[model samples]
Each structure stands twice: as C-alpha cells, then as structure tokens.
Target: MTSAEAVPFRFFSLQVVRTRRLGPSLVRITFAGPELRDFRSDGLDQSLSLFLPHPGQDEPMVPIELGEDWWRGWMELPEDVRAVMRSYTLRELRRDADGATTEIDIDFVLHGVEPDAAVPAGPASRWAAQASAGDRVRLIGPSAADNRSIRFRPPEDTDLVLIWADETAVPAASAILESLPPGTRAVAWLEAHHAEEAQKLSVAADADLVWLVSDDGAPAAIDAVRAAQLPDAERPYVWIAGESGRMKELRRHFVNERGVDRRRVTFVGYWRQGLTEEQLREQGE
Candidate 1:
C-alpha cells in the first residue's frame, strides 16, 4: 500500500443507490459508498474500469486485496468465476456540501436487451438492465481530480470544436459538452438508434447539437458531418468516438478532409462491431 503505484487510481467498493431511464436505450445507475469520498474526477469523459458480478452473485469478485497485482490475480480466476469487467466513462459525480463525492453516475447503453432484439445482451448490459438499490459492484477509478483517464483535452487556442459520436459514446460526448466554457463555439453530431434514445443535454458552450436518428433514415455519420458547413475558425479541435471502424473513418475525415491538425484531434474507439470485449482484449495482447 506504500508503493505510490495506486495513487492515481484504486479499487472502490460501491453499491447501486438508484436507477433512472434516460431514454429507451440508455439507463443511468447511480452508485454510492463510503469509498466514494476518495473518488476524485475532473468529470469530462473520465474513464474507469467497472467490475460486475454474474447472475446469482451478490457482489463482483475482485482480488483487490492483492493491491497492485489485482489484475493478474483476477485474470487467473476461471472465466465464469472471475468478475466481468468493462470500461465506461463517468457521466457525472455528485458531491456533498463539503465537496466530498457521495455518488457517481454511469450511463449504460442497453443494446440487445429487448425481447425482440437481434442479438442477446452481454453480462454488463444484463446486469445494468436489472440493477437496483443495494446491488454491489467494484470500480477502479481515479483518485486524483486530474488524471490520464480524462481525455477530452482541447488546446487553449482552439476556437472551434467539432465532435461526432454514436450511441455508445453519447455519454462521453455529453460530459465533454457540459465542461466546455461558456461562449466556446462547438458543433456536435450525436447518433441514436431510435428517436426515443435522444436525451436533452446541457452545455454552457455555444454548441449546436444535431441528433441523427437512425430509425428516421439519418445519413451515415461521416456523410452527415462532411456535408455540413462549420463556422469559420483558425484553430479547430475534433473529437470522435464510437464503433472502431466508423470512428476511424470520421478521424480521417477530420484530419485529411477538414484539415484539422492531427495533434489537436482526439479520437477513441469505444467498441468495435462484431467483437466482444474478451476477444478485443485477446487481440490486443
């Protein structure tokens, strides 16, 4: 525990305090615990590792007591026994009057959860779909306000901000928009599978938000962005996140077609279509 290795991020034991449905495909689960007093975040798109339990288990199984070796120990467990881990962005954090974090929210996309869905829901999605008060979980999150996990960084000189995100990345995009300074010029295109999946977002920036509903035959994400005209600005910053293949296409459109400086653009592939989290981890290794 004295190693300073866990200073930036550490394990937190939390329980579901409540749940709210933001849209047809989106659910917000709020968690609270004494461990949250140490949970610090600058909030815009802060990322974390969430560990959930399989059905019939009361809490996630994680060998956090192993300290820095928790990952290796957790991985050594049987696939079915080991906690199901997933990466997610912080939607928001609530604090007490003394500025101590009391509860934190994470938005989950309930993909494939419907009875008539084309595909079946994964472990995390299933758990979230049924999450209720007192359901326990584990999270490896930032203990510092400014950490590397928060990736929405726009250069100080950025005069125009552009963003594009699919359903999977709407939470991150929404958090980023809320953090922008008032009067900052930004344009964001957010894609949703159904019109009911669209949620009202709050932002201080002079941001124009466009909702692209797939059910309504909205144009392809790249095509929509490419066809729109951006306001005049000398320095522009672009951020795109979603399915890996589509994210790459948007990144290229921003860097090559839009002529935005590659250094100023931040792109993240939240998930790849046709690949499970376990499969993606295997490929990465």
Candidate 2:
C-alpha cells in the first residue's frame, strides 16, 4: 500500500519545562509548547529537527517557510547558508488536561568529565547541561517517513519483545516500552559506559531489563549484547539502536541469522563513534 505524504512543517516555540539527570551520563530535557496541541503522536520513534541558537546568539535560525519544496531548496542552498540542525527523537508526548499544552522530552548524553574523567565532551550535552526552565528553543519537525510503519499492538499470544540501545537512544527506546500494552512481555538490553550510567527504567512486570556496561575497549556493550541468547521463539519484535557499526551488526544478526521479519524489527544508528552529530548526518546522506 502507498504511504501518505508527510504533514506540513510548522515552527514552534518551545520552553524548557524541566531538566533532570537520568543516569551518570544521560540528561533529560522536557520541553512544552502550545503548538504541540495538534502534534501527531504517531511518530513516537521518529526524529525531529532542533534548531538551537549558536552560542551568544539571541535567536535560533529557522526557515521562514517549510514544506517539501522548501526543504528541497534548503538542501540545495550553499552549504554555508544552511543553519546547524540537530536530530533528536520524539521520545514521549504528553498533553495537559486542557490539551492546550504538550511536553516532549529528549535525552542528551554527557561527553566529558570536569577535571577528572575519561570520555570526550558532547556539544548537545553542554547545551543541555546549561539550559534552564523557561529557556526557549525553536523546534521544526514531525517529519514522516516515506514508507515506515510500526505495530504497537502485537498479537495477544506473542511471548516476547526485545529492545536494545546505548545512551543516545535510551530516550526513544524507553518511550517505546512505556507505550506498550500493560501485559506485554519483553526484554531490554541497555548498554552504557559505566554501571552508574544505566538509568532505572520503569517497564512492564512481564518485561526483563538487562543493563550492560562497557568497562573497556570499543563497542564492548554491543559485544556483550551480541554474546547473549535471545528468548525462546515466541515471535518477539526486536528494536536496536546505538553506535552505527554496532547497530548495523545487530541488524544483520536479526535479519540474516535469525530471519526476523523486517517489519517487526526496528534498528537505528543514533550516533557513531568519533563523529559529531553533523558528521553523522552527512554520512547518512
């Protein structure tokens, strides 16, 4: 069946409602806006564009008009003319009692340590760390995928659902689990650099949660997840996200080795090692 065209893009002014540390390295920022009243909730796992103001800049740069043709023109513009655009997951959408206000959350992974830490620093991490309540940010998105679809309601008899991700995708993965049916049985594999970096997630009673820490070496968490055994065949749906290479590897295992139906499994490369968010976008193109 043919898919529907994307919803027209609209710019919205979002205020930072709250911020909290989810784990040692993960920070959650909740934003609310009046424009979100009509926001479509179908794109739970889909990405949105965040136009943040450059340091010291008073206003964020956003396109005056938005549409397919507008996006095409923006893409065709000189490289220098395009503003910095960051990709983030929809995470969760919550509407107020009156439905006039909506809250959307996004998680950012802290990159570096103060004077005594190891990992490198992340740009988004820094921005999130300093953002305060009432701070305004420009949001432009809810872009629909060309032929993407997901089934939230699995068969009643299905025995298991599997989810996996690293820090960058924890927000999206967690949101997905939270929206699942009350009694759905599932297993989640979350990878983190340190034990403390794993967030205490709220999942269904029937779900199994596994946290894997990467103490050393490259892609250690992915290795741990790969080495583990999946649940007994009960037609479980799998979702995996994280480092580009690791996600690609797991996608292969799910599709080629296990023969899972493509439609039942979702895989996303939230980020790649040694590359900035901008670099990842260019690579994706």
Cα RMSD to the true fold for all candidates: 1.7, 4.5
Per-residue alpha-carbon lDDT of candidate 2 for residues 1-285, written as tens digits (9 for 90 to 100): 112233544566678899987666667899887666655546546567776655564555555465445456556655544544666776677766875437888877776834565765555555677777977777765434321423233445566777887867777777777766677777787777767666666665477777767763435655666676776774777788778888778877777877777767767776677887667766762
Model 2 poorest 10 in a row by lDDT = 143-152
Measured against the true structure, the TM-scores of the candidates, in listed sequence, are: 0.95, 0.79
lDDT at residue 270 of model 2 (Cα atoms): 67
Error of 1 at 231 (Å): 0.6
Error of 2 at 175 (Å): 1.4
For model 1 the TM-score comes to: 0.95
| Tens-digit per-residue lDDT, 1-285, candidate 1 | 443244988888999999998877789999999989988888588888899999988889998888889878988999888999988888889999999899999999887899998999888989999999999999988888999887788888999999898887888899888888899999999988888877787789999999999899999998899999899989999888878899889888988998888998888877788887667776871
Candidate 1 off by > 4 Å: 2-6, 282-285
**Candidate 2 Cα outliers beyond 4 Å, as residue runs:** 1-8, 66-83, 98-101, 116-120, 143-158, 215-219, 274-276, 279-285
What lDDT score goes with residue 214 in model 1? 88
